[model samples]
Target: MINKRINITQKNFLLFLYIVILGLFGPVVYWVSNHNTQLPFTGKAEKNPIQKRMSIGEKILVKANNDAAKQEGITAFAGGDYVLAIEKFQSALKRVRNDPETRIYLNNAIAATTESPFRIGVSVPIGGNLNVAQEILRGVAQSQDKINRNGGVGGKLMMVEIANDDNNPEVAQQVAQKFVRDQKILAVVGHNDSNASIAAAPIYQDGGLVMITPTSSAETLTAMGNHIFRATPSTRNLADTLANYAVNVAGSENVAMCVDSDSQVSVSFKENFTWAVYNYGGKIAPFDCDLAAADFSPEEIPSQAISLGADTLLLAPSVRKVKKALEIASDNDDRLTLLGNHSLNTYSTLKDGQNDVSGMVLSVPWYQKAIARNSFIVNAQEFWGGGVNWRTAMAYDATQTVSQAIASGAERQNLQQTLANPEFSTQGATSEISFLPSGDRNLQGGLVKIKPGKKSGTGYDFVPLNMDQIIEAAPKPSPKGATTNPRVKSK
Candidate 1:
């Protein structure tokens, strides 16, 4: 009985050992077969989690390095060390070429280095009451100095060089050619008169240089195919606004225009004024004056207005001329109401006319009183050490616009292409200025009516003109093919 029990126990123990061996070997065989099995779609092994995790970590590290490079580049750029900034940006690009921010800094550095530094070229009139031109240039110089102090466009110093065209079309053309050929300037800021600008347009177009006129308002300029730009509204719009305001708002029935015959800007103003006056149920009588005439008398203008039976007169001339015209108009008829252009909006002009300009109305894009209290304005003034003029503000806006375009990765050659972009809108100082495909600024208008006085309390009170009011009051267009005035060919 003892021998049989020992045999049974040994058999049971063998069975138990066999079961343990199968349990270990079964999983190994199944794993090998499963590893060899092809996936239905990919025919490859499933992705490795360990490898994917390593790749993600590497990507994050690269991103961190790129960010560090970008921050270093901006600091260098802001400090005006464009060379260092360029090197840093190029290194960053090697790691993150697809980054938009990296591309902007690279382009800006290229532009700053490639263009002439500390130099600006202007095509402006040489003589004939150059005070306005002088003031504009002075303002530009001040702005350049300020910008350089703060680390210029890309932290480089800037200088402006003025070129005189003597108000002669041929001279203007020659000067523009010289600016491009000899100077290789990147941009121009003048050729103040519309006639001068038109004459020089072809040269600037060929050179691919940008031009921003502070005063030119010819409608044709708005269509110049080059990178031409202007801060003032077009003459067509100005005339329409003035006439509409005169007849509709001021309640004038009879209007007369005293125009500067020798001035192209004046001729444009007169033609547009006539169309607006007649379209708004008002009559217009025209009087022409030689802008070059030294002994201009208010009596001469009054005689013309009296003959036309005009109760309202529009004077479109430079500030000096406007002041003289106002004096003549007031002397000729105290009952006469004066309507003027943007040239009359300055404190210098208003001060010259003092009580003479009491009731005259003018339109402007911005007013000092309106902006004086704003923090941005205050900061701008403090930055520049005083009140900033319209020209300075325009320059500021232009610089900001250019910087924003660069920041958005716009090519130096195609800066204008980014004018309509939302980034440009966000970068400007005063207003959100975006460009129409036509190269004109999309901006709003403001109106200020002059009241008599010297002190802050009585100098001028401005009423903001709503966009709807401006649109409704705009002058109607003349009938098709009806010429208000003969187109004067540029000399």
Candidate 2:
């Protein structure tokens, strides 16, 4: 029923937008096709020409002729060729994620003894953060393709099944339960939000499954258990990096912050940034606005900062609010420097706000410019038809790390102990992958600034700004209530 015929490029771009608005929450969706769709399994031609469309989502492969394959497999089973029967049935279920009929045949055949495909479960907030989930799925799906094409991990074909949790804590718990029910699922690769990941952790921990997250960097998740790990840096490290940039690099004496009281990420960052700023001899403004209103007033932002004598303004709202704030800031003549958290590290911010976002600074574990310096960026861009964001990059790294673990002989039984080994390390697109004794991502992130450019899809790019740019002359201290209302024109 998908009448929308978008080209591959548009599909990729649209999915990127989905990632930015995920914080707002939405319904989860899955891409499904009919059971009778013709597959690569058989050569039979239909009497009627059926219109067909290719899915950009994961195509669960089906048997060319399920009936024929089942019969042949049965014949092979009767002939005592359990290996042949298992092979035939396994082929029947290659792209099929769940099929009880063939699953029994394949399991029976495996009992007779032979190599089998390794299955992994991928869980993400597909509905709530479709865009981020899409990018992460692409990384995982493409990695699965690459590994299978290159003889797979440990010589066993890699198979994956995807689940959508919509980023809800309860929904994530259900997804985790489903993953646990599927005994063949040796490991899991998801639960994007820190809350959802934390909610699902106990199930995975008790179920004896390996869980590796790509972008859930909340500070408390790693304490779940030995079975849990992540590819992105912890919130503590990310906040420290950004705080250093704000206090040491940006050299701001007074930091004013606007936070969303409803967002856990904002709250966590507020605490970290506050401590980091104070520790580095930078004082925070007395007036801190914790606004829960989504459609917050832009005029109030500058008014608060201008009146509080703040030299720099940090925003912890969603992208839409940030864009409005930027639009408002661009017209102001108060010489206020705008600062952002990792949430603003997205293509939509620059694409929608355009010139307004120029000079805006943010901190993330990975940036497109820094990633481009790595060799994997080229191939990833060529394959995905756009630049890979932090979500995609981290997801790719997570897959590579897990694949290496599997190749190095880590199994469901010992994967926890194996990943916990301090000696264990894997190379990634952005940097080396390793876990700490606390099971947190032992990583150091980079800081970036938006510079004028026409190269990126967003009409600007994130450039790695080091200490030199951070040490620029601090804006002259403005006396409280001294500046005239520069926003008079906008009003």
Candidate 3:
């Protein structure tokens, strides 16, 4: 009886061990059998995938049947085949419904068939961190329309590729790579964000592609290479301009700068501005100002400005912080002349805090003059549903610069050379825009003040100020026996 029980136990243990081993290796064996049945296994094939990938050569040669017309169009367009381009664009239009941009491209291509199309790529933050990307895109579209309407570049219709970079650095690099690969594309207008512009600039420089940043204002952006350019003034430029206004226009002997401590642009602006103020013989008031705190009293800057006897309160903070400080300053000091950089010259500023910044001073690259006469600006009211800002104006300028460069017969690699020429100037919306040897636009910018009864979309329109006008307006005695504007001498 004992021997029989021992044999049964041994058999059971062996069976259990076999089941456990099979359980551990079952899935692997089954996968190998099924996957290896179709193709010879070199142990490199992807398992459980829905489709197989083609080799590089095969992928390059193959064209999709679904997008055959679009592919052919792209090929023809890139190869200087305008007749084929027009045909393909028309075919694409018929197949792709609700695609306004495609229709616009087709119409422009049809209208300007004398010469081949000149393609320009545009990268904007369309998905993630879509801060004013739509507005920037509208500016680009307006430029495209105006350029196409004005007989196009070199009598060739302008075609544009609008890509979304999401304002992420990695994504912007991908966008730059795509632009480099497209042979038809000669120039790009994009990267409104400073970081994105900085990230993609190296790729553009290496690819020999011309990249024009519309609103990026980082100090080191143009230092990347000769192929990179910006239409907007840098933070240092804005800082210097603001410093001049603080001392000369606002007549501030002691200027208190309440800057955002966290932002690189703010730090750069503050450093450059401090030196500029010192050079102007103006005193710097030691104010304990912090703009990076998540929660703080709005009265921090105003109280410091008043305590230090600062005649001018220069605000360099986010828009929200600016509005908050504006309210506190306007209520605290009746004689204080609030000053800001280009960031404050916006419709939202007028709409949200007009009364607070009623007598505010701001220096910017574009203002009423550009807004009044440029065809793009004139029609912007109807197309964009409001007045245009500096971003829009600068973006439009960048596109126009590229168009003018191409229209003047600068082709392929010659475009950057022509743009770098000292005599090369393009009629921009704001003024004649030409690049410096360092790829920075040569501009001094302009100053503006908020005035009543001159309303636009937001609240009141900003009237441009001259040094003489501001000086003459200063020294006027107020009803409260206080000087709203202090006396100052202009150079």
Clashes of each: 2, 8, 1
Alpha-carbon deviation at 106 in model 1, angstroms: 26
RMSD in order of candidates: 25.3, 18.3, 12.1
- Please provide, for model 2 over 10-94, each residue's C-alpha lDDT reduced to its tens digit, 9 standing for 90 to 100: 7888888888666444332211242433333232213212101111111221223256566667678657787788777767656
By lDDT, rank the candidates, best first: 3, 2, 1
Query: Which prediction has more favorable lDDT, 1 or 2?
Result: 2
lDDT per residue (tens digit) for residues 1-491 in model 1: 99999999999999999999889898987887889553322312144221211110112212333577776776787677778877877887677543423543454554466554434555545353344444354444444434554666554445444565555666777667656554335566666677788888777777776676766776777576647776556676667677778887888888776666666677777777776677777787655554447777676776677677878877777543566666665675556788877666555655556676777776554444465466446655554344444544554454444444544655445655565444456434456657656666665444667765434334643333453675676655457424543334452
Each model's TM-score?
Answer: 0.63, 0.69, 0.68
311: Cα error in model 3, Å: 3.2
The residue-by-residue lDDT of candidate 3 on 1-491, one tens digit each, is 99999999999999999999999999889998878343422334255121121110111111222266656665665566757867886786577532334444454455446557778877776564333565565666677778787777666777666666766777787678767766778899888667688899998999899999987776778999999998887776677666767776667898777766754455556666776676655777887666766665665556667788887777776433455556555565556677777757766667767677777888777665634466666777655556667777787889889998987888768889989989999887757899888898887677788877455755577778775465454443235422221313120
Query: Which stretches of candidate 1 lie above 4 Å from their native place?
Result: 1-131, 138-159, 162-171, 182-184, 286-297, 318-320, 369-376, 383-389, 402-412, 420-429, 455-491
lDDT of the structure predicted as candidate 2: 0.68
